[model samples]
Target: MQKLTNTIFLLFFVAIGQGQALPNLDSLLKLVPAAKEDSGKVLLYINIGQQYESNHPEIAKQYYREAGALSRKINYPAGIIKYINNYTFVLNMQGQFDSSLLLNKQAVEIARETKDSINLGKALFNTGTSYRVRSDFESAIRYYEEGKKVFERHGSEETQAIANDILQLLYYSLEQFDKAIEYGTAAVTYLRKVQNLPFLATAASNLGISYARKHEYEKAKALFNETYNIGLKIHDLNAQGSSMLNLGDIALQQSRYSELEKYFSKAEKIFLELDAKESLVISYRGLAIYYLFQRNYPVAAKYGEQGLAITNELNLAFEKRKTLETLSSIYIAMQDIEKGEEYLRMSTRVGDSLLSETIQKNTIEIEKKFEAEKKETQIKALTANQKVQQLSIERKNFLNKILLAAGAAVVIISLLAYRNYKQKQKIQEQRIAELETEKKLAATEAVLKGEEQERTRLAKDLHDGLGGMLSGIKYSFSTMKGNLIMTPENARAFERSMDMLDSSIAEMRRVAHNMMPEALVKFGLDTALKDFCNDINQSGALKVTYQSIGLENLSIDQTTAITIYRISQELLNNIMKHAAAKTAIVQLSHSEDTISLTVEDDGKGFDISILNGARGIGWTNIQTRVEYLKGKTDIQSAPQKGTSIHIELKTS
Candidate 1:
C-alpha cells in the first residue's frame, strides 16, 4: 500500500512527460504454474496481476496486457477479466482517466464472469485512486470506499487496509481532522495486526499529521514517535526518514525549533545517503526556516534555493508552493517587498489551484441522491465562460461596426450598440446571479425529493415485510406463552419462551426505530444519529462514536434529515455484514449551505465491484437509497482496511 503511494509521488521525480513501464505481464505470466495450454498461462497471468496491484502497478499492467491477449487467443473468459483490472490500474497510474474508466467497465464484466469480488474491487479502487490523484478527492474517495465494500465481502485484508489509508489521507486533505484521525487510527491498527510494517508507519505518520493539524500536539507527537520507532524496527529506511521529517514539521509548528532542526537533520542524513533528493526538500526547507529564525539570511537563502530546485525538478505543485512561501519570507526579511510580493502572488496562485483541486476531489461525492454534474453548476460554468467571451467580442465588434459606419449612421449605430452593450452586461450579471440561486435551489430540491422518496419506501417496506414478520412472530410467541402450564418443568420452559418473546419484541422495536428514526424529525439530526449509533454500539460488534458541528435545528429539514438517516442506516448495515470493524464513527457537520455526514468503521472491507455482484444486495440498496435522496455518499474500504461512508447534502 505504501509502495503504491510512494510510486505515485515519486514518479514526478523520475520524469514529467515520459510514461511508466511495468513488467506486470512477465511477473503474472510466471504465476500460472507452467500449464502449457491456455488455462495455465491465463491463470498465471491473472494471479500475478492481482499481486502487482500494490507493490508494482506498472508490472501488474503489463501482466494484464499480456494476460488479456493470451486469454482472448485461447478464449479464456476469466483470464481476460483478470487482465482488464490490471490494465485499468496501469492507465489510472499514467493519468489516463477516461481510458481507465472504460477499462473499469470491461473489468466489471470479467468480474461478473468470474464472480470474483477481489478483481471487482480492484477495478473500482483503481478508478477511484485515479480520481484521487487527479485531485478529485470526493469522487476518488467515493470510488475507494465503494471498493471497500467489495473488499470486505471478498475478504482481502491487504486491499482493505490500503483503501483505509487512502481515505485517511483524503479526509486529512479536506481539513476534516477528526474523520482523518479516526480513519488513520483504524488504518494503523489493521496494518499493524497484519504485520504490514511499512504501511503501518505510513499510516501512523499520517495520523500524526492529522493530529498535528488539529493542534493536538501531544497526540501528534506520540503518533509520530510511534511511527518513527516502527520504522526503525522494520528496517524501513524510507519510512523512518519520512517519520523524522514529519516530526520536524510538528516540532516546528509547536515552536520547538531545536527539536525541529534535530529531526530534520536526522532525516536529511538518511535521504542524502540514499541520494533521494526529492525527500530532502522537507529537510532543506526546515533548515531554511531555522536559519531564517536566527537571522542568517545567506544560509536561509541557500537552503530555500535548494528546496525550490528539488521541488521544481519534481514538479510537485504543493511542495513548490511551500518553497515559494519560504522564498517570499526571505525576500521580505531582506527588505525586498517587491520581490516578496511577487513570490507571494505566485504562491497564492498555486495555493488556490491546489485548494480548488483538493476541494473538488475531497468534497464532491458519488452515490448522491442528485446528479453530481448538476444543472445549476453546468449553467453557471457555461455562463461564466460565455460572459468572458462576450465581453471580449463586444469590445472589438462594437468598435469595428462604429468605424465602418459614416456620420449620422455612425452616431445611430454607436448609440444603439452602446445600449446593446450595457443591456448585455446587465443581462449577463442577472443570469449569473440567477444561476447561483438555481444551483442552490437544485441542491435543495434534490435533497428534499430524495429524502421523501426514501421515507416512503422505508415506510412501505416496514409496513409489508419486517413489520408483518415481527407481528406474526409476536403472535406465535404470545400464544405459546399463554399455553404453558404451571408445573416446575413447564415453568422453566415458560420462562425460556418469555425470554425469547422479550428478545423478539426488542428486535422488532429496533427494526421499527431504524425504519423511521423518529428522533431525526423530532429531536433533529444530531441526537438521532447519536441514538442510532448508541444502539449499534451496544451490539458489541463495534463501537460507534458520533460528532456534529453547527448541526442544530437550523439546516436540517424533515426531508434532509430523513434522507441522511436512511443513508446512515444503510452504511451501518454494510458494516455489520462486511467490515470486520471493532469501532466506528458517525459525524454530522453543517455549513450555511451544505450538510456533511460520515460513518467510518475499523472493519474488514471488500472491493466495490463485488458489492453489486460478488458480495450481496446490501450495497446496491444503499447506493440506490443515496441516489434517490439526491444527496451524495462516498463509500470507501479495501480488504481488512475498514470502511468510510461520507454523505454530503445541500440542505439550504
Candidate 2:
C-alpha cells in the first residue's frame, strides 16, 4: 500500500500529458527560436518541461525555472503559478518536500491575490501532496478538502474528479477505506466517462487497492484488469506494473499460488525494466510471499531480504514492517528459531511505531477540527451579541424621541398624544410578535433541512460503510466453513448465525432505504413513491396503490418532495400497525400553482375528535410537516369505517 502511493503520484504526472497531444521536443525547440518573450513563451517552457518531467526531472526543473523567471519579468501571475505548480511536482518527485511546500505556498498567495481560482486549486492540491509525502495526514486532508471545494466551484468536472482521486489516495493511506471508496468511485466514473485512459487506469488501480483491503477480491480483480488493459492502451508501464502487483497480492490472499507467481513475476519484470525502486520493493515482497507459500524457504528469504534492504534504504516504514514479518515467517519455517525470533521482534517494533504514528496523526486531526468548530461558535456568539446591542440602542433612541414629542405637546391635547402613543406601541408589539413567528418558522425550516441532510449522510454510511463490512464478515465466515471441521451441534449453531447475519443485513438495508431512498434523489418523487408502494406490496403487509397526475414533466423541489413522501410514509405505517386495513390508495397531483396529496385506507378507524386533543408522534410529525410547508391538512375518520387524509400546498 505504501509503495502504491508512489505509483499513483507517478501516474498523476502522466495524466498531465493526457487530454491533448503534445508536440515533440524538436517541434517545441523549433518554435523557441521565433517565440517572443511573453506568456505564450512562458507556457511553451512549461509545456517543454512537462515533456521531460517523468523521465528527466532535473531537465524539467531547468525549463520550469526559466518559465518562472520570464513570467516574473512580464508580471504574469498565471504563468508564475503554473511554473511553481510544475516545478514543485518535480521537486516532490525528487524527495524535496520542504522546497515543494515553500514554492506551493508562494503559488497559493499569488493565486489568491490574482483571483485565479483554478490555479489556486492546483496549488492547494500540490501543497497537500507535499504534506502527504511528509506524513502530515491532518494538514494534507485539510488542503485536499479545501482544494476540492475550489475545483468544484471554478474548475471543470474533470478537474474536480482529479481532486477526488488525490483525496481518495490520501484517505486510503490513512486506512479510511469507506471514504477512499467514496471519492475513488467518483474519480473512476468521470475518468471512464471521458475516456481518459491514462488517468482512468491509475484511478481504477488505486480504487482497487481499497476494495482489496476490504476483502473484496472479485471487485479488486476486475478493477486491476481494467487498469491493466487501460495501461496497455496508453503505454503506461507504471500503471501496468502496479496493477499486476495488486493482482498478485489478491492471489496471495486467496491462496491461488500458481497465479501468484505469474502475476508477481510479470510485475517484477516491468518494475525492473522501468527502474522503479519503490514499486520494485512491492514486487520483491509479493514474490517472497509466493515462494513462501510454495514452501521454498531459501528463495522466500532471499526475496524478503531484498525487499527489506530497499525498504531500509528508502525509509518506507510500512513496507519495512511487512518485509520483516515475511522474513521472520520464512526463517521460522526453516527451523532457524533464534533468527526467526530476532526478526519477529524487529517486525513487532516496526509495527508498533507505525501504529503510534497513525494514532498521533489522527489525534492531531481531531484536535484541529475541534478548535476550528470552537472558534466558529465563538464568532457566531459575538456577532449575535453585537446585533442585540445595536437593537437596544435603536429602541432607546425611539423612546427618547417619543418622550421629547410628548413634553412638547400642550396639556389640553395630552389625552390625544397619549392615545397616539398607545396605538403606536400596540402596533410595535404586533410587529414584534410577527417577527417572533417568522423566527420560529425559520428555525423549523433549518431543523427540517438539517434532519434531512443527517438522514442522507446516515443512509450512505449504513449502505456503503457498515453494509460492506457486514457482507465481508459473512463472506469470511462462509469461506471459513469450508476449511473447518466441526461437530454437528457446532455446525447447526454456525448455520443459525449465518441466517441471523442475513436477516441483519436485510434489516439494515430496509432502515437505510427508509432513511433516504436512492430513487428519491435520482429519479424524483414520483418514481420514489412508486418504488416505495411496490416494496410495500411485495412485503404483503398491505396492498398500496399509488398514482400521480400532472407530474410527468413537472419538477418538484427536493424539500417538498421529501416532505410529501414522509407524510405518505407515516400514514401508511399507521395503517399497517393500527388500522385493520386490507388496501390503501396514495394519490399525488400537481397544478400550475399548487400540489395536492391524498391518502385513503379501508380500515377500522378512530374517532376524528381524538385528533383535536393529544395524538401519537407519527400524527404530530405529519401535522408539523404540513405546517412547515404552510399547507392545509384535512382528515376524515369514524369508528368501524375508513380514514382519509388530504394535504394541499402552494407551489408558488
Candidate 3:
C-alpha cells in the first residue's frame, strides 16, 4: 500500500491561473475552428489540451498532437516545445514513463536551443517526474534538485511547488522519510499560499502518507482532513478521491470500520465514475482489506483480484505483490489452503521479480547517466585543449615577429658596435643584479620549505599526540561523571569543566586541520578547498564561494597541491581580515598543461602598485609561492573597485 501511495502524483498538474475562470471545453473547441492558422491557434489547442488533461487524458493527447502539428507547420520551435511539455503529462498519466521521458528530453533540447530557462525548468521537472515514476530515483532526485534551482531563480513558484511535491514522493519512495516530509510540507505550504487548491490537497495527502509511515498518525490525520476539506471546496474529483482513500486507510488502521466503509465507498464511486484506474486501485485495495476484516471472504477476494488486475495492467510490481499478499490472507482466513498457497507463491515470485528488475533498471540508469557525463567532460576537455593550442600558436607567431624585428635591428647594431660598447658595462651590472635576485628567490624558497616542514611536524604532533590525549581525558571525565557523587554546585562545576575540555579538544583539532588538512593529504586539493570554504560559510563570517575542476583527477604532485592550497588560504585570510568583504570567490581551474587560481572579493581595494612597498605577510606569501612554482601573478585593483588576483602555473 505504501508502495502504491503517491504513485498517482504525476497524474495531476497544478493549474497556473488564479482568480480566473477556466475556459469551457466546448467554447474552446468552437473557437479553434474559427481561429487563424498562427501561434494563437497553437496556443488555443494547448489550452484545450490542458482543460482535458486531468479528466480526459486521451482527448488531451489528441489536442496536444494537433497543437504539435500546427506548430511544426508554422516552423515554431517554441510552440512545439510547449505542446510537447504539456503532452508528456498525458503520457505520464497513462504510465508511459519511457515515452514520456523521451518527449521530455526532446523538450529540454528545444528549450535549450531557444534559450528559454523557464521552459527548460519545466522540461527538467517533467523528466524528473518521469524518472521517479520509472523508479530511477537517483536520476529523479538530481533533476528535481536542478529544476528546483532553475524555477527558484526564474521565480516560477507554481512549477517549483510541483517539483517539490514530486521530490517529496520520490524521497518517500527512497525511504528518506524526513526529506519526504520536509519537501511535502513545504509544497503544501507554498501551494496553499498560492491558492492552488488542487495541488495543495495533493501535497497534503502525500505528506499525510509520509507522516503515517513515520507513525505520526495524529499529524497524518490532520493533513488528510485538511486535504479532504480543500478538495471538497474546489470540487476536484481527483483530489477528493485521493484524500478519501487516504482517510479510509487511516480509518482502517484505527479499526473504525463504519467510517472506513463510508470513506472507501465514496472514493470507489468517484474513481469508478472518472475511470481513474490508477487511483481506483487504491480504493480496491482498501475495500479488500476492509471486507477481509469483516469476514466477507468472497467480496474481499473479488476486490483483491480487481486491484491485482489493475496493478498488472499498470505494470506496478509492488502493488501487485501487495494485492497477492492480501489475497493470500483472504484465502487463508476462508480455510482455502490450496488457494492460499498459490497466492503466497505468486507473491513471492512477484517480489523476487520486482527486486531483480529494480536492480537491473538502477544499474542501467546509472551507467547511462555516467556515460553522458563522461561525454560532456570530454567535450569540455577538447574545447579547453583547442583554446590552449590556439594561444600557443599566437605566442609562437608573436615570437617570430619579434625575432624578425630583432634581425633587422642586428644590422644597425653591427654598424653601431662602438656605441653599444658603453651599454655593455651597464648590461653587465644588470646581469649581476639579476643573479642576486635569483639567489634571493632560492633563499626564499628554502625558507618557505622549512616553514612548511615545521608546520607539518607541529600538525602531526597535535593531531596524533595532543589530540589523542585530550580525547582520552574527555572520555575519562565523562566516565567519571556518572560514578561520582557531589553537591549540586560541584556537579555544575564538573559539567562546566567537561564542556570546556570538549571545546579545547575541538579547537585543537581545528588548528591541526588548518595546519595540514587531512582531506588535502587524502582526497587531494579540491575536497580540501571545498571543505575550507564550506567551513567559512558555515561560520556566518564572510561568504566564501569556491569552484574547482580537474584538481582531483588531474594528478598533480603533492608539493604543487600544497603550495597552491597555501596561496589560496593566504588570499582568503587577507580578504577576511582586512578586505571588509561581504563575499569572495575562489576559483581553481586546470588545463592540460596549466593550472590557474583566481581569488576575487567585492571589498575595498588599493593601488596595484602597493606591492612595491607592501609589507603584508599574506601578500608576500602569495607572491613568494607563485615565484617558487615559476608561475605568474596578476593583481588588479583600484582605490574603490574590488580586487582580483590571478595566478597561472605551468604543469611541467
Candidate 4:
C-alpha cells in the first residue's frame, strides 16, 4: 500500500484520474459544448479529455491533440497553454515524455504570449511531471513550487491540493520523512473530497511507507491496509496490486517468506489478468526472491525465468534487466557460477543503456522545468500586481457607492453597522495577507537561487578539495610501497594497512559521489541508486533488494538523493552496530506515483516504542535527516523480533 502511495496515487497522480464521479466524454461534451470560437472548442475538448483521460487515454489524446490544434488554429495563446496543460497530464500517464515535453514547450510559448498567470502555473506544474518522469528532481521541485505560488494566487482547492501533494512527494523522495509527513498532512486539508480517494490512498500509503522506513511497522502496516481498502473500494486493480506488492515486500524483507508468498501471489494474479506487465514483473521477481530465500531453488528459478520472459516480450528493458539480475543471483546461489556471470552480463548491458538514456532525459527535463518555473514566477508576480491595482480601483469605486448609499439609508446602515464593519475588516485582513504572501514569494525566489549556488560550492569543495587530496595520498602511498619487500609477517601487516587505506579512499569516494555523482549529474538518480545498492549488497553481509513499479524513470533532485543516502546510511549503520543481525534487506520501490527506501534488519530487536523515543544520537539523526527532506519515518522493533524501518515519500 505504501508502495502504491505516491504520485499517481498520492500526488495529484492521475496517470489518468480514476473514480466513477468523472463524467463520461460524451456526457462532458454534451454538457459543455463548443462555443464556435477556437478557444471555446479547445476548452470543450479539454473538459472532455479530463473526463476520458483515465478510462480511455487514446480518446483523451484525441481530444487533447484536437484542442492543441484548435488553439494553434485560432492563435489563441491562452487556449494553447491551457489545452497543453491538459495534454501533459495524459502524456505523463502514457509515459510519453518526449511528446509531453514538446507540448509543454508549446504551452510555455503560449504562456509567454498571453501572460496568463493561472495557465502559466498549471503549465509549470504539468512541466514538473515531465521533469519528474525524467528523474530531474531539482527541476521538478522548482516547477512544483513555482506552480504552488500561482495556485496560491488563484487559491483554488484543486490547485492547492496539487501543490501540497507535490511538496509532500518532493520531501519524501529526499528522505525528509518527518517533513514529508507534516506537509503531506497539510495536503489533506485541500484534498478532503472523497472523490480524491485515490490520491488520499497514495498519501496514506506513503505515510505508511515513511513509518515503515522508521521501523514503525505497526503504524506502517495500518496505513498500508487503509490504503488498500481505498484501492479496493475504487476497484482500482493497479492500485490494489501495487499496495499488496509493498506489503509483500515488507514480509520478504522481514524473512516472512510464507506471508510474502501469499501477498505476492495475489498481486501477481491480479496484474497478470490485467496484463500489467510492469507490476507483474515486479511481483514475479519478488516471488522469486521469496522462494530463493526459502531455498526453494527450483521455484525461484522458474518465476525468475517467467518474469524475464514477459519483460523480454514487452521489450521492457528495465524490467528485463531486473529479472535477469534476479536470475543471476539465483544461479549464483545454486552454484552455477558461469550461468550467473552470463546473466549478470546481460543485465549490465541493459542497465547501462537504461542509465544513459535516463540521464539524458532527466537533464533535459530539468532544464525545461527550470525555464518554465522562471517564466511562471515572473508572470505570477506581474499578474498579482495587476490584480492588486485593479482591486484597489474597484474598492475605491465601491466605497464611494457605499458612502452614498449609507448617507441615504443611515437608519438601515446603523442597524447593520457591526456586520458591515466586520465584512470590511475581513477584506482588509485578506488584502494584508496577500501582500505578505507576495513578499514571501519574492524572498523564495532569492532563496532558490542561493540554494543552487550553495550546492555548486559544496560540490566543488568535495570534488576538488577532498577528492584531490585523497587521490594524492593514495598515489604517494602506492609509490612508497611499490618496491618494498619484507618478511612474510611484515608483508601481511603492510598489506592489511594498504587494504584499510584503500577502503578509506573508496569510502571517501563514495562520499564524494554522494556529494556530486558524475553519473547522477550525468545520468540521473535511478542508475546511480541501482549501482550503489548493487555495490553495497555485493559484500554479502546484507541483502539489498529493490524494485520500481509504474514509473519508467523517477525524476528527482540532488538534494533529495543526498538526504535519502544520509537516512539510509544512518539506518544501515544502526543495523550493523546494534542488530547483531545476520541479514539486512533494503529495497528501492515505486509505484505509478511514489518512490521509497526501506531497510529491514533481522538482528537483535528492542521495543521500537522505547528505542525510537529514546532520543539516542542515531534516532535523532535519522529523524532530523528525514525531517530536513520533509519526509516521514516509521520504526519497528521488538526484543528477539528484529527491526524494520519503512520510509515513503510522495513524489509526483
**In candidate 1, which residue ranges exceed 4 Å CA deviation?**
1-109, 135-138, 156-163, 233-237, 269-279, 334-342, 345-440, 443-652
Query: Considering lDDT, which of the candidate structures 2 and 3 is the better prediction for this target?
Result: 2
Which scores higher on TM-score, 2 or 3?
3
Candidate number with the higher lDDT (1 or 2)? 2
On residues 1-652, what C-alpha lDDT tens digit does candidate 3 reach at each position?
Answer: 3433455455543322211235787898899768999999988888887777656778888988998999999989878888877787667666677888888889888888988888787778777877777766667878878877878889466776777777787888776899999988888888878787766777888888899878788998898889879867756666677778777776766667667668878889988977888678778878887787676879989998999899889887867776777777777667676887798788778867865765565456545655575566557556755765676566556555666769765556444543544465466557556655665565566566556755775686567545644554455456557678999999999989988988998899999999989899888888888999998999888899899877655787878889999998989888888888899999999988999999999999888886899998778778888888899988899877889999999999
lDDT string for model 2 (1-652, tens) is 1333334444443212223346788899789889999999998998888777655667889999999999999999998888888888676555567998888889889989998888888888888877886767778889888888888788888887778888887987776799999999999999988887766876888888889888988998999999889878756576677788778767766768778779878888887876667678888877886786677879989999998999899898877876776677677666676897798789768867866776566556545655575566557556755765676566556656676667554443455545755675577567656655655565567567656866885686567545754664565467568878999999999999999999999999999999999899889999999999999999999999999999998888989999988988998999999999999999999988899999999999889888889668998888888989999988899997899989999988
lDDT of 1 by residue, 477-512 (tens): 454456656788978886797688677767766765
lDDT of each: 0.65, 0.79, 0.77, 0.66
Residue 332, candidate 1: C-alpha displacement in angstroms: 3.4
TM-score of each: 0.46, 0.53, 0.54, 0.51
**Candidate 4 accuracy as TM-score:** 0.51
Per residue, candidate 4 scores C-alpha lDDT tens digits across 508-582 of: 666666555566556766666666667668867666665544445667776566556557766877777788887
Q: Show where candidate 4 strays beyond 4 Å.
A: 1-20, 24-56, 66-82, 193-195, 212-215, 294-296, 313-318, 332-337, 348-652
Give the local distance difference test score of model 2.
0.79
The C-alpha RMSD of each candidate to the native structure, in angstroms, is 26.1, 11.2, 19.5, 20.4
Best by lDDT: 2
